[model samples]
Target: MRLAAALISCVLCVTGTVGGAWLSRPASVDYGSLLSKASDIYAVTDERGDATRLYVVNNASNAAISRIPGAAAELPWKVNVTYSLDGPNVEANEISGASGLVGIYIDVKPQSSAANHTIPVVTFTVPTQVTGDISADNTASVATQGSDIVVAAAGNVSSGLKFSCYMDAKK
Candidate 1:
């Protein structure tokens, strides 16, 4: 009788745990689109001084760019951005340089208004343009964390621009 009771208890515990986890899990995010949007939204390597507004544009051309088989925007620094399944936040890792270094990384995510308890809609507004040597791996990844999209980009200033920097965004 005790053995049967123990087995029943274990089964019930397992079932409840699984059910709870499933209910708590967030909806899946379309990481591919988010990654593409993130890449499309660009900021200066060191635009901390300027109050640059970062937002994603929803247009035919931008969507078409995302669908392109082999299309990627080149970044100035020798940094590589990739998608990953494991990351609570967008970040850069494995930063190194052989010929001296001054590296920087920028990550952007949804921020809710504290007073209003509402998320601000990020849309492309002003057209800001600056010129520099742009280069990238012509590659990206569609990684996610539950319903939130996350990216993992890591690189070193091995060649090209001496200073390395990277940026990320989500839609």
Candidate 2:
């Protein structure tokens, strides 16, 4: 009886330790590699020159869309989108109640051949209203599916929602 009890306790201790370690592990994301394949990415700006959208050159005529867009295409550059939910990089106050506003910043750099030019960073705000179609996971996630930069934040609402917006990489 004594030997059995000691063995059970030892097993329980090992199992608990392993479970705790696995549960407490911190998660990480590789932002740099996310948009590494994106090229000829442009920042769409309003009449005032404020970035309102992102456009990736595909087979369409980017120049005919509007000359007001950022110089990413003119400079023939690639872009990196740095995104956030609620922190220094995000506009935390704008995400109150039903307001689903997210702050997005894009870094535009010249191609490797034009390395001498300066890097341009454009900032903008996008509305990601919550909807029933989304699942409530209480966490934020982002990814580039084809030409779209999909941002889903399920923590804000009960049913959760997603913002399948940005980068009209029309083929």
Candidate 3:
């Protein structure tokens, strides 16, 4: 009985130690490799020129997530997403009768070759049907200020909802 009890304890100890290490394993994302895949990757902006559509990498494998609508050919650079109530999710957040306004700050750029340049703040009412990673359809500005291009479009409501600036490698 003593030997059996000791054996069980030893087995449990070994199992837990190995299991803990396995559970805590972390991995690195190689964004460079994904970017080099010869696909048309773009970072879109909103009207007035705010970068509402900041990049949202998949937490699963650091993969870039994009939802192309059926009419994507008409506007290839646009980002469209489908909200899922029963969609595949790694997890979900629960709300307990919460009511208030909220805001999100997104850091984005005009072109993929361009570095991250602007910060756009998006605020919306709570309990709204906004979901699926990032901002959606609206208008933005990638125009000019005086001579130089005006990259930051602040206080633009349409710009607050959609992305205008984009990258097109389809040439």
- Per-candidate clash tally: 3, 0, 9
lDDT of each: 0.26, 0.34, 0.28
Model 1 lDDT per residue over 1-171, tens place:
111111100121111221121114459876676657553554333336663654455453635323333345322222223322123322334322111121232222222222122111111111112211122222212232244322222212221111223232211
Alpha-carbon error at 96 in model 2, in Å?
16
Per-model TM-score, in order, reads 0.15, 0.19, 0.16
Error of 1 at 112 (Å): 36
Order candidates by TM-score, high to low.
2, 3, 1
Clashing pairs in 3: 45-163, 45-164, 45-165, 46-140, 47-139, 47-140, 47-141, 48-141, 49-141
**RMSD, every candidate, angstroms:** 23.9, 23.3, 25.0
Q: What lDDT does model 1 reach? A: 0.26
Checking candidate 1 for backbone clashes, the offending pairs are 74-135, 74-136, 75-135
lDDT by residue for model 3 (1-171), tens: 111111100111111221121113349777786655534544566657766654533343445557676564231112232222222211113212222222222322222211122222222222123221222223322322233322222222122223333221110
Number of the candidate with higher lDDT, 1 or 3:
3
Candidate 1 regions exceeding 4 Å error are 1-138, 160-171
Which regions of candidate 2 fall more than 4 Å away from where they truly are? 1-75, 88-101, 114-171
lDDT of 2 by residue, 64-144 (tens): 544553454443344445444433344434334422323444334444443333322221222233321222122333333
- TM-score for model 1? 0.15
Best by TM-score: 2
Clashing residue pairs for model 2? none
lDDT agreement of model 3 with the native: 0.28
Q: Which 10 consecutive positions of candidate 3 have the poorest summed lDDT?
A: 1-10
